[model samples]
Target: MPIRARGARHRTGPLRSPGFLRSLVFAAVAALAAVLPAPVGAQAAARPTESRPIYSYESAVREAVWVDTGLDADGDGRGDRVAVDIVRPREPAQQGRKVPVIMDASPYYSCCGRGNESQLKTYDAKGDVVQMPLFYDNYFVPRGYAFVGVDLAGTNRSDGCVDVGGRSDVLSAKAVIDWLNGRARAYTSRTGTERATAGWTNGRTGMIGKSWDGTIANGVAATGVEGLKTIVPISSISSWYDYYFAKGAPLYDGGPAELADAVESPDAQAHCAAARQKLVDGSPRSGDWTQLWNDRDYVLRADHVKASVFVVHGMQDLNVRTKNFGQWWDALAANGVERKIWLSQTGHVDPFDYRRDAWVPVLHQWFDHYLLGYDNGIERRPMADIERHPDQWSTDRVWPPSGTSAATVHPVNGPVPGVGALSASPAPAGTASTFTDNPALDESSWAANIDKSTPDKAGFATAPLTKDLRVSGSSRVSVTVTPTTSSAHLSAVLVDVGPDTIRNYAGEGEGILTGTDRTCWGVSTAGDSSCYLTTSADKADVGFTVFSRGWADLGNYASDRKGVPLTPGKAYTITLDLAATDHVVPAGHRLALIVAGTDNGLIDPPPSRPTLTLDLARSGARVPFVGGAGAFARATSGARPNVAAGVPDGTPSSPGIPVPRMAAQRLPGGAGR
Candidate 1:
């Protein structure tokens, strides 16, 4: 094996892109203010003379209004607009306190709502906002802050087509920011009649949200908008393409436009039918990168990000995927952007749902430190706050930690070509691994019986570890192979082959289950509830779960965007990247690499299935295992139906990738340390 190693430490966060760039020259120029303040950084640390709370929770002015987006997305000949529902302190203006703002711009307001319960927004008879989902308004309003809920254009009262991450979606909320700082214009009606402005704001603002809402924040901040002091995007999509595609593989046979339709309004779907058709037309089904996707990709424009980023993401989030964060995080770091990250084991969940007690106050301090410009000393803290175990978190100076190194494991051909050992030592020359593509087998079924031979897939394993191994970052697999067909889709998955242990994720819960009881960390109001369902994730041993997986279409070996089909009898070298991860493999555990021609469980099977012949002599995998060995040395010391049958994490089925069945399901009792 021609093994190579790299041990560089780096930071991680979160993603952003597209056609909007063509209209960039005509884009709006002004940034906005929020929290109706005197001026940014005015009264550094002075206390108010007023006896009442500057931000009175009981007396907040709850109002609903519209902001002119200045675009006719539906060809209605009228400017598209967005609805801004606000709840702010009634006493701030009198206290001479121009408060900074915290805003949540979401598309879920009228659809799925927010939080674990999916609470939607409610309004009064006069069309004024009566209810705003989540505890943001209820908690922050009393603390001298304004909580603004904005309905993205085409959803709720906002007017326009749902172009996904296109102009309509981005500019609607941006117009609200403009209205605050006096940069752009807004109106009181969807008819473009009455004008409106933010006479009650301080101009400086910070955006906070989870999932799609968080994605919007990331997209807007990437526009280099001024007054956007910071953004807290949790488990959000940085690239819609990344959201729907993996290494050129489409998710559920749908592309970006289909996703746009998923979130689009039913009434507007027909109105935007032409636009939707254009979306489908522009998005290439061949998996080639297009300007359309580029226009919507925030990561491509990350260099323009001026706002400090406080990112929160579940590392196990298969929905949005950590790739969205890790890739964008790298770009932001390369551009020297200031950032902080919270990497949780939970999948697609808010920190409030994961870590309730510490999340709110920590968030408060973060917003105060940036939006309020208060000397909260939050910047003095570590760069990363990572969850080491369920309900157990610790801070670190940097992510991927410091004392980490990379290692490469090669395929060791033996009894048969496709059957082998993964090691640091070189395999004999002319060795090969062959498997015809099969869509039926999953990661578990293919790898579970390594002792038995199968023609559908290939399996390789390393000797038991002699010391504890910690892998932190993305892993890669490159192979020299010959295919029997022009096109081939290969799935490479990294699996942890080990004894029964406490799995971090049992069905996306991160070993934490939502219970019936409720816990109120903060005060709640009628409209905004602070009480959330509690979590119950025990430190119990469970089954084997996929560590990370990556896929590649053989036709795209030359470029991720373009495809060059292989000649039936010729050899080609293809490389696939496993998901970025930070996992600890115990000394007695084994590491396995499973490769197959197709993962029908995750994607649609191509019309033609191809048989692949891998030259094991040239095939190898590189693991960014932090502090591992120079060789795959031998160990000195050394599941059930659905795999997580009695594991008890409360998650229904495994999310993203399913756990390997019979890997290690049944577990006896052991108290959590």
Candidate 2:
């Protein structure tokens, strides 16, 4: 249901898919009937005018357009042009009032009338269409803002070759924006010329979407197009290599089996296979490829973007790593751009789902503040609002806000509820917990696998809160461990466990109601046998500046044979840093910290073996608290303010990286990559 651009052909008759075409056909018919002048008197006068539906809010209004155009790629006379469709919203303020336009761009053939009709009829029990917002005509049109859904230049109905991450996509977006501005001025409405003029003249256009759409937003923003306002990239990775192929390792060899199945559709599989081959065929170390990837990369130099921004991401998102969000956040901070971020316990697919009513208001507030110029209680809210549990919304002035306290809770020696502390000393060497990594024997090893009961993990907790404790910002943990081999994967989760219910305010229906309960957070990897814990320096205080190898190696650690042994009788710290979040731990709720060598149930298990050792006395965790006098606690000892290690601290680079050259791919109609 992702949006695509409008193309020429009309299939005629009833649509086989649940799409705007069927509705558009009806409207067109009605228009034809009304203007025929054959039926006189009452019948003719009673016919309703073919008008776009309007959704009115306190500050804005919107009208949807269902358009179809021909893809005349070579200016040829033959009927070779493919059919395309698009759904655009006419925003009153954007015309001349100078409102910002928000768009969702993807190559998924979103508007290509395919199986849409059948899909539309299948609604959830709540009567809302399932995944309907992804449909062009359904969501974007009624939002009271200008929304453009394009078919990537050479996919589906769009002409040209499918360049993947090439220049055509970005250029097409720019062209669409220009077209919208002109169309807005030309299309006069009953509201008068002033409204039409204001819609385009006074408007600032921005982009917002997830996955593919998210990537496009970044690309368009990078173009430095005038009036390009801001972007809200959800669950998107800036670097293709870093995100999909390598996160310090090769492609997740055994990760996300579901993705494999999802891509198995003949068409999708073909596209993905080609794309993967392109990745391999194109040299990884090539400056050309690197430059091309970097130019298309959203995170490489986020500072290049001058737009005010807001980012929202989930901690447990297996599809896209949470660290990518950190990269963007840090980039904005480094550029000294005003921004806001929201972190949640949901996954990549949840944010756009309507089951989360909270998002509706939040999005409205954001657009109101930026596009409509209506303060309307938006600025009064926290710069960042995160969800620790479903019922609690924690607010903060900035991300990873200051004022936090750290306390170590031992694993084996830590007292269990109703049980006193068992030991005050560290365990002997090799005296640690272990789990086997037999992917063949494990069904739960798939990516994002969740085990709510008897989780294969250990936890430490603080006593029930004496007062309402709001914990906002990133959370980090340091742990000591020994792997069975040269390399191992480790994952951690921070949960607010108690009698209070923790709702996932993002997912849909049964998925939302019964999805994983833990508000899973950030993750880091270690590549070698070293005492060091891994975390992205990009999230550190000064923002994202590339560090030389002399500073920090931006890769995971690898261990030696016999694995890195945990020093017996010595306590080592394992830091679990959570992404910046907003949540209030109500009085009487305990802040639970769960540490595991793997999050196999919720995500793909690491390709390496892992063993863990916990230090009882010297190891501790940290949590940030804000609000009220004496309501917060300060770090007691052994707690050092987390700094992004290995990066040149506080030094900003100039001009950033240059755009790389890309090799063109050929298309069906002799189009080049």
> How well does each candidate superpose onto the true structure, as a TM-score?
0.84, 0.55
Q: Residue by residue across 1-673, what tens digits does model 2's lDDT show? A: 1012221112211123545556556544553443345554666453533232232221223232211122222233321111122223334434322334666555553322211111211223532222323333342233334444455544443443344444555655555555455532221321123322333434466677665556667667656666666777766666554443332322233322222222222433433444434444553421123444554576655656766677777654444556557656767678787677777655454453312335544665566456545435555557776655543456666666665443333444232221112121333444344333432322112111211212344443344455666655444555565444444444545544343333321222211332222210111112101011111101111111110000000113221101233333343333433444445655554444555553322223444544444443434345445642235332111222112431111212221111111122111101000
Question: Cα miss at 458, model 1 (Å)?
Answer: 2.1
Per-residue C-alpha lDDT of model 1 across residues 188-304, encoded as one tens digit per residue: 666667777677787888998887788888899888887788899888778877765666766446555665565566656767778787788877777777777787799988998
Query: Stretches of candidate 2 above 4 Å error?
Result: 1-100, 111-145, 160-203, 238-276, 281-297, 314-318, 341-345, 349-352, 355-365, 372-381, 387-412, 415-458, 463-469, 504-555, 558-580, 603-673
Clashes of each: 23, 73
Worst 10 residues of 2 by lDDT: 545-554
| RMSD to true structure for each model, in Å | 11.7, 17.2
* Predicted model with the maximum lDDT: 1
**lDDT: worst 10-residue window of model 1:** 7-16
